[model samples]
Target: MPPIIDPTKCTGCGVCVDVCSEDVFFGSKKGKVPVVTYPEFCVHFNCCAYECPEEGAIKVRIPLPLQLLYKGGDR
Candidate 1:
């Protein structure tokens, strides 16, 4: 699944668009919330969510199966 951008928090800075390698927000404009253009191409990289300047702006949910397989970020 693609990352969900919270319109309430997003400043339309286009940082997410620049950081994402998947071109998920290809058509989004400079002063508008990004659009999830190609959901099927999403790799669940979590880069967009991590790089978002505003807290709670971007949320990327990893499927349960993939969560179990990766076993990362455990501290």
Candidate 2:
């Protein structure tokens, strides 16, 4: 799933944007919360959440199919 940014916690530091390999986020340099432009491009790498300085600022939800694939099991 795509990362969801908490506007309240996001300081618009652009760390999430800079760390994302899929270019999922976009925003201005004037401290605006980055927007998720392409969710399908996200590979669930968790880089955005990992790089976010604010706790709970970015949340990444892996889809059920992807979760099963990663877990090596069937539901």
Q: For each candidate, C-alpha RMSD in Å?
A: 4.1, 3.3
After the best TM-score superposition of candidate 1, give how far the Cα of residue 61 lies from its true spot, in angstroms.
Answer: 1.8
**Which lDDT tens digits does candidate 1 get at residues 1-75?**
668888999999999899889888888899899998987677888888888899999998776556665556867
Strongest candidate by lDDT: 1
For residue 58, give model 2's deviation from the true position in Å: 0.3
Q: What lDDT is obtained when candidate 1 is compared to the true structure?
A: 0.85
Off by over 4 Å in 1: 63-75
Q: For residues 1-75, write the lDDT of model 2, one tens digit per residue.
A: 567878999998888888787787744353788878888888988998988899999999887767653555555
